[model samples]
Structure formats: structure tokens, C-alpha cells
Target: MGLPWYRVHTVVLNDPGRLLSVHIMHTALVAGWAGSMALYELAVFDPSDPVLDPMWRQGMFVIPFMTRLGITNSWGGWSITGGTITNPGIWSYEGVAGAHIVFSGLCFLAAIWHWVYWDLEIFCDERTGKPSLDLPKIFGIHLFLSGVACFGFGAFHVTGLYGPGIWVSDPYGLTGRVQSVNPAWGVEGFDPFVPGGIASHHIAAGTLGILAGLFHLSVRPPQRLYKGLRMGNIETVLSSSIAAVFFAAFVVAGTMWYGSATTPIELFGPTRYQWDQGYFQQEIYRRVGAGLAENQSLSEAWSKIPEKLAFYDYIGNNPAKGGLFRAGSMDNGDGIAVGWLGHPIFRDKEGRELFVRRMPTFFETFPVVLVDGDGIVRADVPFRRAESKYSVE
Candidate 1:
């Protein structure tokens, strides 16, 4: 049924103006989400408070180009390292939130502009006398742009080899020899930009994205292809999108759970099993407990801390073996520890000690099925060390 003149003038309906209105509404929704995220980051941010634990803390997403030039969240007050940063700018929580707010404002303005020009027939196709949009072309353009960005960052080793301030705290404070968060998956030592670790991963992904974008842009997809992909109709498209969302979700979940290289140790923190009732949080609690027990003065107890790796023996079910395993004691031919056991450390202004990050323990690092001298498997292995029943038996 056709709408009345008054209704059509005042409200949006199934007309040419509806396309413009939908665009405006979509922009507004995106703006709202960005604004909300900014607010949430602001709410959680506390400059005065210090999170001593290195494993768990608020995370920030930094641009590769900006970070490569040493523009990052170097504000040391938020973490255990307390001091003024040498090269700090709009890369911290405050800066990211502000950027989001600015983006949201721009989106809102664009939405308003679209709303004002709702009656425009710019999108109307001359042949059909109806609005038409090239969604595939737009997607291809987006992919191309994203691929270029990723390729530029990864190929140049923007964050790992070049940027010192991102992985570690206060790049200028220390010597030029800077190590990455996961050196095994990154360039190590004072080598000048050798791209092989996580950089390779990014480069591969970027290349694929670029190729996909080019294919979409140059070639007109066949009807059979659209039908095969379940994108022939709006209903099929929606269902396919839902399936894609779930598939992506499961992939991410598996990566995080298994602690794959995709979820880098530097960016997303350690795996769930490593920290969830395992060594990470346990060591932190043990240190605090020791501090409370030893010191008589209640006021000065927190300030006076225990040494790093001090209370390792006290943790776990079997205290006799201790938290760390010695490679020297073993009768193996190589007599060398294989895994990268290093973790990020938090320090004071004068480079004095504060706390050490607890990475994976000996048993977790090297999965050894203990064997007796008589070529038989030993029964007394500390498989499940912690009291928490979550760990593997």
C-alpha cells in the first residue's frame, strides 16, 4: 500500500529515501559502539593505582607505524614501573580512548549529513528506477587497504625488530639492545631488522588479503559461485554470515586455549593453562603472603618485597622438587634447557628490582614422561602440581 502524503513527508518508509536512512542508521550504530568502548576504557583506567602483576593488566592496541617510531604507552605509573616516559604520546589508554571519541564524533557528523540529504537520488539506478549499491566493490577496497597496512607493518618488522618501546617498557632508559616479548617468534639481539618471526605470519596473511581483494575487484563473480557460497539471496547471506562469525569465534578460542603463535605471548598474554591456577598468579600470591608474614610493620610491609623466584619451592603440591627444574642435574647428553622461559619484568625508576614475571615452569615447558633406570615409566611424577583440579593429570 502507498503511504499518505503527510506520513511520507514526516517518516521513513519503503521508498528511495529509505536507503539513505539505512546508511545513516548504520553509521550511527557504529558511532555508538565506538563511543561506548571509549567510555569503558576510561572507566577502567586509573593512573594512580598500580597493577604489580605483569601477566594480567589492561591492554592497548597500538598502530604498527606509530609504534615503530616510538610513539606508545610509555606512561610507567599504570604498571609497577614508576617514572616519566621519554617518548610518550597518544598511544596509551587515554590516547586510544580519545581517538575513539574523535572517530565516533566524525561518524555521527557523517550520519547527520546523510540524514539531511535523504531524498537525494544519487544511488538510484537509471535502468531500474531503484537504488543500487556496489557492496562487493566496497568490500574489495576495504580488503585492499587493510592488506596494504598489514604488509607495510609486518614486512618492515615495525613492532618487533624496529620498535623497542612496544614489547618492553622505556626503550630510551636502557641500552639500544632491546629484546622482543617472544624472542623465539621475533628477532633477537642488536641485529638491524631481520624479518622472520611473527612478521612472516603477518606478511603471509597480508599477501593473501591483497590477492583476494584483487580477485574480487577484477573478476565478476559467476552466479554459480554466489549460489555455492550461499550469498545468492539476503536470507542465505545472513545465514552464511552467522556461520562465518561462529567459525571465526571457534578458531580464536582454539588459538587462545592451545597458546598458538597466532596469539603472541607479547600481545595476548600467556595461555589459559599457564596462568589459570597455575604458576603465574600462584607466584604473585605467594610473594604477597611472604611479605605479609615476614615483616612486623603493617605500614611498610608492602614496600618491603621478597626476592624474585624466592617462594617458588613453597608453591605446588610437591614442595621437595621445587618449582624450577635444573638441567645440570640431568644425565642427558645435551644438558641444555630448550624452551624460552623468560617473562616480562617490572622495575622501578632507578632500574632496581620490583617483581619478575612468572612464565611456564620446568614440567610445563618440557613435557617429559619420567622413566626409571630400568626402562620403565616412573609413577611418582608431579603431573598435577597445583591444588586446583583444572590442570592436566
Candidate 2:
């Protein structure tokens, strides 16, 4: 809605006489959020504060429903290595990029909601008497700076950064080179534009951004927390709360469901938006329905499945054809371990399990075509790895 309003009608929408009200409101909201985030990043890195936990302060998110920290890995996995991004913008098992997008959308909505109730005169009008600080000057500067950073910094990262293995998604599956969070520095095969290493800079920026947000609000004098309550606020809050819950369930339940049942599709996101969990979930159901034939057992039909081997090469390696297999230690031959079947389970021909990987993708979460040693015929194995490293058992 924000993008549409701005994009489709920027001239008219931003016209001082037209949608000036909306522009001011949305701008303020964006300003507050973006400014706070930048400020939080700064404070989190304060050398004076003795809390030496460099990145995400583990166990800080004590919400009972929350699991672990909101931190995610360079790629999709339990641990965070390549660039340790913490508090990661939002919460979810769907990984970083997806979470980031969701938060962006959420903040957009919150900003929109702010304008629906209050007039644009002040950040907080309910405060007793005129406070020491001036509203126009403070919010005015904050609004400008925040807008600049959100767009400028955001563009710098998206356009200039994003190295190989930095991990992003696609309509079909995952694709990226192994790289770092810093700008343009990584393993030889990865993207030069994307630098790899400890994302301490990000940590500092994020922590300070949070602090700035709190401070900005704190400086807004005082108002009852619910001062802005209105019919629109209630309706919007209720609607958003419902949507948030549903989205959470979709990402979480979908990951567990798909990761367990079908071949796990490794997703690398700039944020949580990178996870293709929804696409694969629907595809799994569609394939399961089509695979079930009259008088044919599901198990029998499983092995007799079709292979959708799309590509035949990687940036670095040759293809693997025929029944021959290359042993890639624990990765089962994937270049950068993150293909189908996240969990590992070894098996020979037939249904018996030989050795099971701790977090096999063929778990109850997804539909499985159990491949023994002779399995993986479904792989574009000729390519560096299977469709997703998670696909292997």
C-alpha cells in the first residue's frame, strides 16, 4: 500500500494540497523507524558499555513463544557463521531475508496507522505544556536523516553488496556464491562485491538504531500509551495482529512441515523474504497429489518419480552423471552444503535406514522419495549439488 501510494501517485500523493496529510504521516513513521534502527546500531556498539557480547545477546528475547535469539546464519541453518547478524530485524525460522522483508512491511503498516488517527502537527500532542525541545526541528531533522539512510544505505547494500554464497532465493530454488557480510571480500569463487567476515559493523548499527528509536520517542514529551487509540487504530491493530500470527504460523509450520516431509530447499536471504517455503509447500502437495496413481502404492510411485534437472553446471564444477557418486564428506557432494534434505540419513537400496543425519529433510515435514545409495537420480547432481543441500538424507 505504501509503495503503491507513493509509486503510482507520488506527484499527486505528495502534492502539498493533495495527499499531504498521508505523506507527512507516512514520512514521520518511516523517519521514526529508520532513524531508531540507525541509532540502535550505534548504541549496541558503544565501547563504553561493558556488555561485550559482540553481536546478538543470546537469551535476550525471553518471550516464551520466542525460540532462541532472532539471529540467523549467513545461509539457512541452525548456527550463524559467515556474518553473524543478530536480532535479525524480526523473528522466524524462515531465515534472514524473509524476516527482514516482513519487518519492513510491518513498519510500513505501523506508519500508515499512525496517520489514520493523529493529525500531523506534532509527534505527541498529549504531553503537558510545550516541552523544552522543539517538535518541528527535532522530528524534522530526524525525518530527513532517517529517510536518507533508509533509501541511501538500503540501496548501497542491495545494489553494491550481495556477494556469492551470501545467499538469496529465486522462483525455482536457491542460488548464490559463498561470501561475507562486509563489502566485497570473500572466497575466490564467490562475489567480489560482497565482503565476508564478522558483521560487527552491522551489530553496532543495529543496536544503536534501536536506542535511537527509544530516545526519539522518549523525547516526544509524554502521552498515555494508548493516547492514539481510535476506531481505526483498534481495527488496524486487530487486523495486523491476526495477520502477524498467520504469517508466523505459515513460516514456522511450513518450514517444519516441508523440511520434514519433502527434500529441504536451502534458502539464503538478504532477509527473511528469501525463504521459498510457501512455494515449495504448495509444490510438495501438488506433486504428492499427482504422484498418487490408481492401484499404485505411494512407495512404489516414489522411486518411479520424475527428475526436474534444470541446470547442468555450476560456476566452478562439472556435472555428475550416470549412477556414479562423489563423496563430499558430510555434505554428500554439495559444493556449499545447503541443498535438499537438511537432515542426514544414510541408506542403501530398499527401505532400511543405514545412518540418519540429525536433521534430515525427509522427516515428517515433507513428502519423501527415499533414495538409497542409488537415490539422488532426481538431482541435477551433474550440477555442483542437488537442488537443495537439504534434499540429501
Candidate 3:
């Protein structure tokens, strides 16, 4: 049976309630970042700077840059763009201008989102901090700008400081869109700080939101969200406080654990690991294939560890147990054509390996010519191989 009605309701309310709380917090942080950036560009820095106008748009901006993220409709496999940023990510596609452009564009918009709130905070509430994840006056700019401040500071830490035309080692992806920015704007810089894709990223952003929510949600002369705990008739106390913390933690863990940050084992678990590993494996496959096209066998090229590891690791071959390979060789003639080259039990040829037994052990031996008897004789060794060469004819 599925569940009782009461149990189902309990599950639904608690889980769904948590989810809704998380979503709101996420959007608020992002929106705050976005709105803050807009205000910063337009009002604080004399105007929306007109140069980064593209950031004004939303997700659509990411479409063209999907390839850099190892994503594409046809998976056209990336190649070097013949350009090098002296301090580029050795493993990231940020080295390429196209991907850099797309990611940078995303960050640009994010920057504007945060900047706009700065203007709001400065203009609206000169004395009070705006209510954000946990600021002072909920409506005041203090909280809003603080979220913006955290994000901006984070972004600056990631992307700025790298001079013009230099490939940045943007570990954090905060200044992700720095490449997309025009040189005229002079926003590009080396951001050695604020690395990205860690569990901490979500945690930090969440904490910022929590702080904003606390200050905003708890303030008197409330914003009637009806989404908070009520301390008094019109006053709202941190209604979603606990949920907010959980939401942030979940977001951090979820994003890191989810597809966004696939570790090496996850991507090439059966083979390679992580996106970088996948890319490297793909490169290896390409190179190995090219070598095989000439004279090399595919077995010598492609990695066999994944295939062998999974099969044998899962299946048993213990002395006390039975397996695909028992005690003796699977083939005849000792199954080991011993000589000077290659494994006696196996072939160097591609596809031929399919016929070879992986579980069986192959062995044979050769004779030591005893001139005293006018002939040669042999002794058996567990790992010996069969002799095939003689010139009696």
C-alpha cells in the first residue's frame, strides 16, 4: 500500500513547504543580485553603463555559450581557439573566447542585478540597512545592497585584477562573464579569489539570503508577505527562518552533488571521472583512434581499466569460488604461445581480444638444450610459455 492520507499530507506539507521556502530564497538572492547590479550600473556609476546592456537580458544569453560547458546540440567537440590566456584554467573551457563570452555575459547580468540594489539602498534608505537574508530595515537598501555587496565582492574576487586580453584563472566563476565584457569598459581583471563550483558557493549565497530574509522578514512595519512567523498583530518574525537555513544547506549540497558538479567517478566512474577527466578521456580516444588508423591496435589505445575493473570487481574468482575463469587455460597447447613478444595467452590485435578468455590463466614451457644427451628436454613452470620456433627442416 502507498500510504495513509494523514501520512501523505504530512509528507507533502513538510517536504513541499521546505521546497517552496528554498525556491523563494534562491530567487530572492538572484533577483537581489540582478536588481542590485542594474541599479549600480544605471544610478551609482553614472548610468547603466550602456556597454553591458546585454546583461539586462536573462537565461537566453547562455544559449550560444553552451558548447564551452561541454554542451551542444550535436556535441561538436571543442578545439583550441588559437588564443591563450597566460593564466587560463588548465582544465576549464574558460580558455576559449566563445564560452568565456557566454559565461561572462551571465555574470554581467548578475552584476547589474546586484548593482541596482546598491542604488536602491543608497537612495531609499540613507540610514537604515535594507532587509535581506538578514539585514536591518527590510525596505531599506542596507540589506538589498548587502546581498549585492556579497555577490559583487565575490564576483570581483573571482574575475577582476586580470589585465586586458589575459586569460583569467577564474576559479570561482564569479567574474564568469568578464570575458564577454567589452575592453572599452575596462572591467576585465585577474580574479584569483572567489573560486566556483564548491559546496561553499551555494552555502555562501544561501547565508547571504538568510541574513537578508532575517532582517527583512523580522522588521516591523512589515512587508505583509504572510510568509513569515508573526511576532505581533502586524509584526512578522522569521516565519521561514529554520526553513531558510535548511534551504541554503540543501541548495549547497544539492547543487554540488547534482549534475552541476559531477566528480571524476560520476562522469567516468566506469572509466574516467569529472568533466575534466571526461574531456581528457575523449581526447585520449581521439588520439588513440588516430594512432590505430595507421598501425596501432585499439586495445593498445583505449583504456581497458573500466571494462576490466567493473567486470572482475563485481564477479568473483576466488580459490574457494567458481567464476568465468577456473584453474586451467581456456584454450589448448598450454594456451600460451610463448616467445619474445606480447602476452603468451593474448593477442595484440584489436577485436581478437573478444575471443580471448579474460578469466583463464595461460601457461607453458620450453626445453633447455642439454648437449650431453644430444637432445633437449623441458621442465614445467607455472608461468612458463610454449616454444614455437625451431629450424629442423
Candidate 4:
């Protein structure tokens, strides 16, 4: 009679135990929904059949980047291609879909277990009579899991350090640039190859994350920290939320623009370009097209693609283009063009130079180092001495 649903909601909201139960139920529901959808995808996916765009395949309930195989006709839409199963440590589309199914099952079981013990007062403090979720410890668990995942991907995956041809597409080759990790500081130079550099970054980050998690789980926060952060207050939660958003934003930017993430060319295509407002893959496709037209073979096309040349030009200081700084080339306005720091200038068999690519370090952005033949490091200066006009002793 007297607004029964509102009364029921009030009752549920008031009880902390009930609230936890609701959370579990919510997780279960979401997991079940996602799992069912993923199951459908797995069931319908066929290696032999043509892979359509996810929007066309699943209509409104499309998974954004689910991997697919076979000839694709997306009708001008971007096609998401799966990794090769033959490639070592690469997870195929079907494999990931299966993993989703397993995860759903585990979530369902967890929900059921929580439901059976609905009256358990785990997340509440007996003395305070308030929700006492050990936030640091919980966060530690998440960090540990994330760290393991990142480390695993970096150490073993096809797009990581071990993946021979999949790491990067540079002037040297698809293989990563292996710089010495000796001295820990600046011994030789800091030239991180794509994919490999990305992999190493992940590995290092993962290690730090794991250690931080362990520290958090083991140690108790000081009273000063609690006071400083205004813990147990609504303001703290709001601040944390804002901080989380900014952190996520920075991470996304770094991963996409700076190549910090494990997302590989094979998985998500090349890095987005500012020229197209980061809308679609244009440059890579164009290069591939030109390569294919010239060579008339898919393998040769990929091999001949000079995407790195465009990359060099974008970064500035390319001598081949007669730019200001000579980061890659050894010549200082001289006709004799030489490569910098042993980084090779890739050329086709027809004597046409493809690219003289040299990945710049933080300091290397300004031309300070003098190199001998074959781009050997001979000497270096402190200040900016890039051009031949600014010759110094």
C-alpha cells in the first residue's frame, strides 16, 4: 500500500551487509551478461569464413576490438585483425574469447559463494560501526595482478621483447633495437626501439607495481598520512576519484602517443596520427598499398614499407630532408651523407635510399654527439652545437 518499493530500497541501502551482497550480485549479473555475449562470439567465429565488422556481426552489442580472422569486408569500417596462432606466445582471438567464458564462470561462482554468506560482516569494522574495507590492501591485490599481467606480456608475448619480427617497424627492421642495460645511467646512449622499448617499460613498471603492492599489503599507513589525505571523509573519496581520472588520462596519452602500452601494431594497427585527427589508419595503409603496387607481394610489401621514414620526418632533425639538426645523418651540410650512431640507413636494391632513421634520446634531440664512420660515437659536447656554422673546439 504505502510505496513498498521505496521502503524495500531504503531497507537494503541501510544494511551494510545487504549492500555488499548487492555488489556481489551486480558483479555476477554483469559477468553473466558479458560472458553470454562472448560465448556467442566464440560459437559463431569461423577461421574459414569471412570476418565482418563487429558492428555488422553483433549489431548494437558489438565488442569494440575483439580479434577476427579470414578475409574481412567491413564496408569501409576499420577491421580488427587477430594475432597469428603460429607466432610464439601470441594469444589468438578464439583463445581470448574462451578466457572470457572462464572468467564469467569464476565470477558467477564467487557471486554464489557471497550470496550463501550474505550476513557475513567482512567489510565492516566492529568498533567503528562503518564500512572498513582495507583500501590499501585491496588496491595492493589489484596492483599485484596487474603487475603480473604486464610482466608476462612484456617478457613473453609476440608484441614484446621476445617477439622477433613483431616488436617494431623501424629503419633497422621489425626487430627491436637492443641497447646495453649496463651502468644503469647514461653509459652509451638511450635509444629505445618500439615494441621492445615498450616491452622493457612494461617489465620495469610491473616490477615496481609488484613491489609497491607488497609494501602496501605489509605496512600500515602512518596517522599523518590519514590526516593529510583526510581519510574516512567524503572529501578524500572525491579527491581520489579526481586523481584516478587524471592518472588514467596520462596513462592513456602516454600509451597511445608515447607507445607505453602493450597494444601492438598487429593487435590494434599502427599508432594514431594527428594529421587525420587520429580518426583511422591512413599512413600505414597507404605505405602498404604503395609497397604492394611496387613489389606485387604481400611479404615484400611489408618489408619495403618505409613508414619509419615518415616517423623520422615527423620527429624533425632528419638530415635526408635537410632539416636543422643532424640527429641521424653525420654530414654537417656536406654532400657526403653519413648515418649517426651506427643506426643504418635502409635502402632498396635499386640504390634508392628508403630511410636513414635514428631514434632520438632525450639529449640526442639536440645534436651534441660527434660520430665517426658507420655512426660511431667519437665525442660529445654539453651545449647545442648542431650545425656546421656553430663549430666549436
Query: What is the TM-score (0 to 1) of candidate 1?
Result: 0.51
For model 4, residues 1-393, the per-residue Cα lDDT tens digits are 555763454444434455556656666666666656755654543322112221222221223234311212222232233223233232443344456567767766766666566565675678986655565666678678888887665555534234332323333222222122211123222343233455466567778888888887788789899677665443454468679879988876666453332333322323323322321224454766787877677656555544433332233222123343534222223332122232243333444433322334332346445544355444444354553442324
CA lDDT of every candidate: 0.45, 0.34, 0.32, 0.45
- Provide the clashing-pair count of each candidate structure: 0, 74, 60, 0
Candidate 3 Cα deviation (angstroms), residue 292 = 1.8
TM per candidate = 0.51, 0.23, 0.28, 0.45
Q: For each candidate, C-alpha RMSD in Å?
A: 14.7, 19.8, 21.3, 15.4
Candidate 2: worst-modelled 10 consecutive residues by lDDT: 308-317
Collision count of model 2: 74
Superposed on all Cα atoms, model 1 deviates from the true structure by an RMSD in Å of: 14.7
For candidate 1, give the lDDT.
Answer: 0.45
Better structure of 3 and 4 per lDDT: 4
Model 1 C-alpha lDDT per residue in residues 125-158, reported as the tens digit of each score: 6788675555466557767887887766665544
Which portions of model 4 miss their true places by more than 4 Å?
1-92, 112-116, 124-131, 156-193, 233-242, 253-393
lDDT ranking, high to low: 1, 4, 2, 3
Clash pairs detected, candidate 4: none
Stretches of candidate 2 off by over 4 Å are 1-131, 161-166, 176-393
